[model samples]
Target: MDCVVTGGNVKVLAKAVHSLSRIGDELYVEPQEDGLALRSVNSSRSAYACFLFAPLFFSRYTIPSGHAFRCKMAIKSVQAVFRSLASLEKTVEKCHIELEEQKNRLTFTLHCKHGLLKTHNLSFQDSESLQAVFDKDSCANVFRLLVDAVVHFPPSQEEVTVSVSEERMWVRNHVEEEDQSKAMLTELCLASDEFDHFSVQTHNNVTFCLKELRGLLMFAESTGLPISMYFDEPGSPLVLSVTDSVLEGNFVLATLSDDTIFRSLVRTQTPPPPPDDFMNDDIDSYLIAMDTSIAPGPSASGPPTPPLADSLCQKQPAAANHRTRSYIDEKEDDLASSERPPNKKFCSLFFGSVLPPSSQMNTQLVTSQEVLASDSEDD
Candidate 1:
């Protein structure tokens, strides 16, 4: 009979069952809030069953007829519960899960050896689930282990496979070099449709394959600097062909589409004016002049000598007249000496009488003649 108990203590029922049963016999005890029932069976049992209530809050004692076994079992159960809860908390803390809503589904097409493979319709909901799967510890560990195992035992022939899911589309790029995988992944992320609107084309329910090809080509052009490109377009299957020569002297396979062509044309054309310092023709001319002037050259204007010559010519006559006036002042002093006072002249003559008469007569005559000549020259 099934009986429902609304409010109960499980330990009280266990006590009731112990009181009703014999020491060596097996008993089945059912507990309820209102009442307790016990039935005895013909068996010798060492184990005693005890039910615990409020497992999270209160600790209940389940004493097996023996003490040691009861203690061990209780500790084990509690430890297990604690460990499980701790693990769950850690998992929740480490993860960041989010959900988004999308108005329309998005899809991608991947080129494989067998031809084009279309991906499933992807919504924002799908992205969330994909992110969660990667976040789980067990899933992440398993994925890593699988990759390690694959490296340890590589396949004989190198083959590539493409996978397309609702969230993302990727390829198993089995190149001989491991370093190339990272480059390939980077290219894929760059070429993703989320970033560039021009690279995505949706008609009806399906996304066109040419759009993905265009994205690849655009990525190559942007990142692979100074690239040589070749385009091949065939009538069948509308396949676009692209070949890119990277800056690193390596080749990348890309595809051509309308978007790719447009991007190529845009890159080929000169960029628009900068926001603040637009190209100024005047500034350019000024810079060119400065550069040209740095080198030694003949002056555009004539030599500077005519003004100096004119200044010298204007000062010559005044300098000559100043010199002539100084000479006239010197000659006047000599004439003044000849006209000294008579007493002073007689004293000088007396002093001069010591000389010979001829010398004295000659001196007087010379003096008189010099005076007459000076007067006549002045006139």
Candidate 2:
């Protein structure tokens, strides 16, 4: 008898065979376009089982010539059912698969019905289109499939492990706060003077000492006062002196090298006071006039001699060792414990010779002598 199975009926027959027999027992038969002879076996087993019984089952089955059309039709129906199943399998395979292209690399991921199956990488040329896939619009479709796979198969303790890249590790180490602070401290130490009063301490168990000797030198230049500095050791004690013409100060640098010590001294002298017998305005104008007259012209070969003449003219009378005889006699008598000379020559020379010859000069001398007498009385 001839049997024809249509589309829905073919699916039902495939399911029935799948439930009834194992895959090895099933036979896959494809009939040719031309009509062929009909075949039947006397065996009690199913056709699927009988097909595998011999390596060449076509030769074993007995056929009569009149049944050719019916055999061809039955074989064709069975082949159509297997081919439909194969098509469904291929659709499932393509649905769950995903591919990605980035830069010059291509990646493929296969997500089977059971679980994630495998991943693959391939070399891709730069000019190739990344969207190229097995089917039209497959890129978008595969992207959706990848998203589904990611949602279903999340990272688990056993499946996922994270490792830091070498670049990241280097950046983290270099940008650490403590490391940056240390670098800043080093630069500040190099720029600071050795004797500055400020202190800088670091937590790295290492100390630095900066010398402020240059600061002390500048201070002396500005204030006209000498200063000296002394250091015992790095991060240790310091000393300062400010006596007479010598001024000194020192401090410790608590964050420099051990045995790194420095000391600085600024020597200075006090300026002498104006002479006791000095006449201020009178000598100043005279010295100024002398300075102007003796000033060297631009064509002169050497430095001007006016400054030297002014200095010489301004020297005190006592500096020339030319005291009056009465003053000398008084000093000698005081040394010998004897009576002094009563000569008026010393008084006349000081009171008359140095004074200008004028009525105003005489009046001024008299007033000055009276003022001197009043000062001596007050003393």
Ten contiguous residues with the weakest lDDT in model 1? 127-136
Which lDDT tens digits does candidate 1 get at residues 184-297? 321121123331111212110101222222322333333332222211210001111222221011111111111001110001111222334322223334334433442331
TM-score for each predicted model, relative to the true structure: 0.12, 0.13
lDDT of 1 at 271: 21
**How many steric overlaps does candidate 2 have?**
16
Give the worst 10-residue stretch by lDDT in candidate 2.
139-148
Each model's Cα RMSD: 52.6, 51.6
Q: Put down candidate 2 lDDT per residue, 1-379, tens digits, no spaces.
A: 1122333323323332332122122222212122111121111111111111121212222222352211111223333334445443432232111112223322233333355343444332222110100111111100000011112221221111001111110000111122333421111111123222222221111121111222233323333434432222221222222222111122111112111111111011112223452432254454345335543331232322322221211111122332221111112123113211111000111121222234112211111210111011010
- CA error at residue 252 for candidate 2, angstroms: 6.2
Per-structure clash totals for the candidates: 0, 16
